[model samples]
Target: MTFEDTWKPKIDAYRAKLDEEVGPYKALVEGIDYSSENFNAVEALDTLLTEKDREITNSTAKQLVAKQRDGTLTAVEIYNAFAKRGAIAHIFTNCAMELFFQEGLERAKELDKYREDHNGELVGPFHGLPISLKELMKYGGKVTTAGFVCYLDNYISNSPREESVSIQILRKLGAVFYMRTAQPQSVMHLDTDNAITGRTSNPFNRKISPGGSSGGESAAVAMGSSVFGIGSDIGGSIRVPAAFCGLYGIRPTTKRVSGLGSLSGGAGQESIFSSQGPLTRTIDDLEYYMVNYINMGKPWEYDPNTIPLEWKTGVSLPETVTYGILLTDTLVEPSDAIKRGLAYVQDKLRDYKGKKVDVKVITIDHDLMKEAFKQTLQIYGTSKPVHDKLFAISNEPLLPLTKFFLGFANPEENDILTNNNIKEQFKYYMYYLFKDQGIDFLISPTNPNVGEVPKNLTHWNYSSMFNLIDFPNIIFRTGLTFDPKVDVKGPTNVTDYNANDYVNAPINLQLTALRFEDEKLVEGVKLLDKALELA
Candidate 1:
């Protein structure tokens, strides 16, 4: 009577047939040495971050290009170091789905030759930056199965004659994506767990889950695998992993970037929301990407769906800015670390900046926001129980966690209409949230728990609530993470918002703006990003 009861046998047969042919791949995967890989990977990483931080942070891409012009370092050497680290990262975290190292090296060599020919001068700003990609993105001649069981043999990515639009744009800006990272089955989970590459682990701790479907990108960037990475989001796909892995990421407004030609599991589901953005080490790197990925790529030219808006670099903040502080959404009270982390951030913004920053605490109608967000994620919403049941069929072991999703009834007995109505409420709540707060942006925790145990999933409503509002939100670490002893404190709420279920996690802070007011949100986060020194 369960979802798997009818389809498990069919899906398992398909997986067996595919595995039968991919003998060596299946064999190589069985015995991976994670500890050795993680240890060596982290040791090598410290040096690269140190070098890149000094070179890129001060004057940024503009300065790096200037330094290249002055002959300090060649593009080839930078590309080589990052590529090697990225390879090690794949082994350490199960972060890679496919690779093109040789291809990227060859391109790097060409850039070296170009600089040599001109005595140093070259192309665009990000001429030598190393970037990795999520598997859902298509690059010509790379498989784009995107973790589906049936499409394991799909060669859409291997069609050399056709490259994805994003790939073309990156190449034009002199960016090279030498590898593709992993994703989950439906491309919906906040953690990676698919049939092909399996689940990816957190870079900080291998036992913990990195938020997904963009988890691999966040993990890679966190472990110093790549300088920056591009990932897609719908819900908190970009922010969750960024928060979970302790990195900076932006989920730009849905229409800001190109999602065209990208491989996705649920292609047509857009009512809730979907977007593509960056998971990077530094907020400045994020700016570099947004500026170049917009101005130079000319995404509007390729995808009609993309808004014909260009990056407005000249936009300036007022002499002072006030942030609408949303300490807790009141949906689920954040863990002690989250509360402390936000307080720390609020304090730093006051003392560190010293002057010229105006801050305010704005309480939002939490009951409405929480109720609205909860309604949006019901059984038959964008993430329908039926589709979940279908995807779960491919589950040979039922994923343990998903069994709870099937509910305690036969598939035929589940309520469908009641579910969709809740999903619709998410849209209704957004209309009220912005009207309630006339401030610049809302700040709140991404998850009540920093990083959860592997299969013990609980929170998503924090950011999912914002997703309901269709706000442009981003996540980055404050360099402070979970230390349960220091972070733990008694519950604040006398009722349901009690402290018993909470535990410290690297708290994620969300900066949100009104619909299409992404520029304002980005500016506000950049200030906090600088103050927090998350880079």
Candidate 2:
């Protein structure tokens, strides 16, 4: 049989599974045409939600939790609202790889029953929250396809004990998982596309990408189908998608949160470690999830790789906050929209009415960052042998993006040691810059562009730099959107990002801190959000 004959059946089966899981909810958006040009799925989807659904889905996780605690909203009611919106989001954007609506609702019902039986005591901090997960996270008895067609039948454990450690913690905290989001093939591409579930579109503008490998999560969160979503990041996975979707997300210091049970390539590779965090609509909600997930969950006790550090509370930024704003990585310059967004932020910081804040234009060490970028590509390729085996198992054809990614893999692991040594040197250089300049935090572009056409995202230098140096970074929207009429192209030699193609895409910026300064980083972003009046 031909390649399509072999793989097409698996794709069909995977999609069939999603439909079967979605069940009756499919009728809500059955007749809508999703092929229209430049469709605003996020806006269109909002109208379909009932007033109650809108209220539930629009509220942040913290708000929903507060209502649940006060007995104003039951777990089942919240789940029902999100379930309807999430189903519509999936139909519109293809954001969901798997659906567990029945299971999630049942769990929500149980939480409500428990509350009724116990006089309104919440089961956990995140009681009754509907969370979307990236496809790789194990959810018990579900297939954990890490975007590879070959692993379509690899079902996870059927017991709660076998769920991903992070999932287990979230479950204990009363999170209901109803949807699994999409990722790119090989789980390496910065754009979301794969053979099984296809590409996830940007809800803001269907013409462009939602960003990946957490693209589905970003799309879901942006569509208001989810209050927030969980995503993993190694090289711009979480931050890029969050930026592309105009949401907030973070990549915490490695091992601060457990990644156990999240399957992806590079099982034991430590040259560049992956970290997982939330994608939320508000910075306060982002902090809420982190503080509760780490402080209350205590993931280190469950996942051996997690650090023993508790999520710090009462952490505050320095008296006179110093922000080193990086205009470009000197590798790929940011687009006009991003430049405008940076200028807006700089102006806001300069005009802050609060405590002392200083904004200084800083230049990055291009040679050093370029070398580190190359090292990251090589390190990523070391998992080629393992990925090759997965592809071979089912004779699955490589997607275009996966082929492009594998092309950068080293022939062997010989250079891994050298790659790691260079990483250490780069980290030291960055740390010195922080100390020497007394920089409290660093601000930079989240991507070269606001959003790229699907399967066309390039230049990850802005986001991947943090992954290389193992720093914690948070991505937040600037309350600005790309206006092609105003965000005109510059000299054209500096960037290849065409603003005309990214109309209505939100422009976001990155806030980064030294390694293990996650608490302080969150605090700093909170302050920056206040300065900029981000709601």
- Model 2 clash pairs are 381-409
Candidate 2's C-alpha runs over 4 A off are 1-6, 30-32, 159-161, 410-414, 490-498
Candidate number with greatest TM-score: 2
Number of clashing residue pairs in every model? Answer: 5, 1
**Model 2 per-residue lDDT at 531:** 89
Candidate 2 lDDT tens digits, 374-471: 88888877888888887887777677778877777666644877899888988999999898988989999988878777545656778987898899
C-alpha lDDT of candidate 2 relative to the true structure: 0.85
Candidate 2 has a TM-score of: 0.96
Per-residue C-alpha lDDT of model 1 across residues 60-113, encoded as one tens digit per residue: 455556666788866776766676566656666778777667677888888778
TM-score of 1: 0.81
**TM-score of every prediction relative to native:** 0.81, 0.96
